[model samples]
Target chain A: MASTRAVLIWGALAVAVIVPVAIAAHSPLLAWRSPVYIAAGLAGVVAMTLVLFQPLLVGGYLPGLPRPRGRRLHRWVGAALVTAVALHVAGLWLTSPPDVIDALLFVSPTPFSAWGVIAMWTVFAAASLAALRRRLRLRPRVWRLGHTALVMVVVLGSVVHALLIEGTMGTVSKVVLCALILAVTVKVLLDLRTWALLARSWR
Target chain B: MTREHATRRAFLATGAAAVATLATAASGLLVPARAQGLAPTPSMRGGANNYLPGAPIVERIGGGGFWMTGSVRRAGDGAPLQGVRIQIWAHTTEGHERDPHSHGATLTDAQGRFRLEMPQIVPAFGQPHGHLAYDDAAFETVFLRPVMPSSRDTSLSADFVLQPA
Candidate 1:
């Protein structure tokens, strides 16, 4: 029964990620788009799904992966997430530099662009801190608190960014994916007792 | 004495009327004349994306059974501008909007009107919409993405009143 449940959960996760990419692949809008643009766009779609995996793996929600192994996978996934973000931004930069500049400067007329920029920066900050953790010689508690906070921001910013953009993504599937990312993250954070850490830190 | 006062008052009123008439005429002259008695259509924000700078002209998008139609007129005077190239693209039944097969360009006829037939527009980005653009040196470029009222609509029409560059 448990094995069947694990298979079902994994399958569900697969659908959540695969459905958006599939929808985008068939988007009639792709006809005139540059290859760089398509690659960049798919990277974004993948990154949003990756956001879901971070919390699930860190919280050890997946049955097959042990917590320590899951944490290691989480780190790899984090690196992948950052790489995907770079591809997304780079593709846009190549396609439309002015728009990307506007987004980076936080002066974009489109609300979604700003959200995306915010999420991108937060993800980078989290990645940088992770890389420098040993050099900083921070305590486990401090590291967890800081990383968890940034990850939460990444979740919020990315979800808002994804939701606001009206792009190749299908509406129903996109909303479902965003909602799942949010709910799962919140659940994982709660299970991990993020608030208790905060309380202890305050004391 | 009362007759003299009345005459002075009449002279002031005539001057005021004359001044008002000239101001109205000047204002009309200052504003670009609209021959069609219609205001220029403002471009929508976020209307242009996946725009191809210069897609070649095509006779039709793809065995076009569904009509995508619109008119183009000058903003200064609601005069139809002929020989203007108008590009049309849409997510359609045969191909995605991003496909080269899904995009095509046509010229405005002498009447300042343009039309093309393409496969029926499919829901793209969640709504059934068609994109049209007037990217030429002759007029300020305008990109339009107009949504059809219903996915089942057989045809969609969008018109443009372009400002001179």
Candidate 2:
């Protein structure tokens, strides 16, 4: 029974990430820059998806969950997410260096470019903090607060980025993905608050 | 077996496997040898009136015009395309210099060489038009406007080589 429940939860998590990817992979109407660009964009979406769900995974917010995997997987996954974002930016740079530079410097004539750049920086900050938290000897609460704040920025920026990009994902899929991101975020936050309250009561 | 010996043997086996795996992975990442086999060539085809003798090459030669040069080749097999018409036109940064709509067109010569002049100016905020046309279909069309130079003498070079779509 425990195994079955675990499988179902894992399946749900996979769907949350995979469904957005599959929808964004190809659209008859939108022509991608190249196969490489498409692949990078898809990877970014998956990484963002994982980042959105990381808090829940870390806190073991699943119903009837087993003991969380000693936080090693969490750290590794966070690092992987950062690498994926780098690849996404690098791929875009290779395909269109001028546009990528404009986006990064917030000088892109396009409005959406600013949002993507902001999200990228926020994600990078969050990952860096996560890596250095141990060495820095930061308080758990402070680290958690900082991480959460930056994550919210990343989510907001990503939502806007996805919303503004007309290619591939299109209006419908973009809306769906944005909704999923919001739903997951809300769930994770609520669970975290509840866990905090429970810990306080225990004390 | 003694515990120390058993541990050493296990470690040795694991180390060997890891080394082998790393070597294999590294080789896979190395640049493939070009001389080991025939270099892969892209396929090209000609159709209808668009077919020309010799290959057509278009170059934006940095100054005023894009130099379009190619040998005309026969549609069947690999014969030089010759004499087929190739039209080239793009909007200048100053806003559609040739056409009122900011579009331009020209034809290729007998040797498959053609040149179209573009006046240096700032790129327009909107789309630029430049394409290769044969028969009814236009291929290798760049929808975005080229970055316009600030001065007339400032040169920018771009090349367009068309292949079977």
Candidate 3:
């Protein structure tokens, strides 16, 4: 339950960070009609960020942490993230019909849109794998490698999409998001190293 | 070969495999643009197909005004459009309406020529209280209000090119 609470809190925080930035970028305050765009952009950023961090948070890759009290929290958080991402895409589609169409068809004029769409698909792939991993009878090593690869795909695509956007959030928000991504990546790498060392020592 | 030699060879192979895996992972972290380039410059055809002329005129009132001229090409293509209408309205640097006019509208000619004549710059919102900077442009901070032109115009020219939707 505490783990679930933590995930919910983190997810909300991510949304809060993205909303103001989106409003500033889309300049919804300038016109009421533009609110939809601002909302969608904000939602997209929040969802992408949550998805990027999902694996580490679920896998407990923090430098020092106890195992989550229950798997239920992890499941709830995963479900919520999925919901958020769906809404994000839907909002984007509504706000920019042509761009969203181009992105879906992989023919967007901007590469960043392509990256965002690819990230969405990668997130879907990860979710699918999570659903099937237990039943697939795959080796643990193989599963870990594949999951890590997909997660990286999602993160890379998201970072590119975020960095390319020019809006009110501007460079400051982007830099902060990038730094957080790097920090999370370093933590994951260190956790992997620690696990490998433990396994080797045991052997 | 001694057992020690076999052990060393196995260790080297394992190390090489690990390194290869890490390299692959690192490569995966790059956005797809590294291979495809950052953005596609709009081709003439792509821009031509989406071009709408006379669609961007903000308004046309029978009075003294300022004529702002610009072209609207598809971000995907660079084609001159005809008959797009444009509506131009602006607020003063302080965010007040320029003409005290409620709205303005106009149409582009076959050459996508648009002229907006305004009596004066009105505060758009209220008044410019302070500096408004967008993407690090200070002087570019003048308050410009925009809305999509009415759908009647075939092509649209905007006083300001909107970021591609």
Candidate 4:
């Protein structure tokens, strides 16, 4: 019974990740787009899907996966997310260097570009800080708090960036995906007492 | 192993069928039409009777006469299309539709919206109609012949929803 339940949950999760991308892959606009542009777009989609998985895995929300395995998966997925983001940026640069530079410098005409740039930088920052945690010798709680804050920015920024772009993803599916990410992030943060820390800090 | 192979074969077959069906349905939309018909036509059939093949691209035309405003969007998803050329020509207070002075073009902004000023359209072929065209490689060519609601109106607008070629 538990195995059946786990399968059901995972199936739903897979659907959430797959449906929007499947629909977007069929967009006619892609017919004429450069391969690099298509790669960048696909990377963005994969990164968004990874964002949804990160909080759930760390929070031990998936039914069948044990906590240790989930944590290991979380790290692997985090690495994959960072790599996807790098590929996204590199592909965009190859397609349009001046536009990509403008996006990185936060002066792109498209409003979504600035939000995506902010989110991309925050993803790198979070990954770098986590990698340097031992060398920096930061206090455990402080490190968690800082990392949580950065991840929050990454989550919110990427969601907004995806929502603002008028792409192949339908609004309903995009909103559903984004909402799942946000709810999972909040649930994990609540379990960690991150909000309580903020409440105390505010006092 | 045999069962797994059989399932994979079924999946591949189903996927192929789906793709073939989609391609067949979309083939019609993929082929673009030029000017609706041979040009020098009337009623948005494109080819202004006196089209001066190269109208200089401008922000607004004719010094704030009648307002010509419109938007450009992708047909299926309705996403705002940017930088699409929208050509305009009309019989108006300043000149006749056949006159080159009455013809000019502008581009959609980042939001897919455009506005231009021209002398208010007057009756041409007994109706006050303004002509516009989108002749860019990025999208299928389109011609718009929007008629003014009334000749006295200060402004008229027409929008385009372009399909990918």
**Candidate 1 chain A weakest ten by summed lDDT:** A27-36
Q: Between candidates 1 and 4, name the one with more favorable lDDT.
A: 1
Q: Is candidate 2 or candidate 4 better by TM-score?
A: 4
- DockQ, Cα level, model 2: 0.01
A1-203 per-residue lDDT for model 2 (tens digits)? 97788789778767766776777675542251355656666666676676656665566655554336725566777788888888988876765465577677776555777888898999899998988999999877778778888988988888888776654554664577677777777777776773464355322
User: What is the C-alpha DockQ of each candidate?
Assistant: 0.08, 0.01, 0.02, 0.01
Model 1: fnat (fraction of native contacts): 0.02
Q: Give me the candidate number with maximum lDDT.
A: 1
Q: Per model, how much of the real contact set is kept? A: 0.02, 0.00, 0.00, 0.00
Prediction 3 global C-alpha lDDT: 0.50
Candidate 1: segments with Cα more than 4 A from true spot: A1-45, A64-66, A86-114, A136-145, A160-176, A196-203, B1-39, B42-58, B76-85, B89-104, B107-112, B119-130, B135-139, B147-154
Off by over 4 Å in 3: A1-35, A52-56, A59-65, A70-74, A168-170, A194-203, B1-68, B71-113, B116-165
lDDT of 2 at B141: 23
Kindly report which residue stretches of model 4 are placed more than 4 angstroms away from their true locations once superposed: A197-203, B1-165
- Which ranking of candidates, highest DockQ first? 1, 3, 4, 2
Would you list the C-alpha lDDT of every candidate in the order shown? 0.82, 0.56, 0.50, 0.77
Residue-level error in angstroms, candidate 2, position A108: 1.1
Chain A of candidate 1: what's the TM-score? 0.96
How displaced is residue A61 in candidate 2, in Å? 2.9
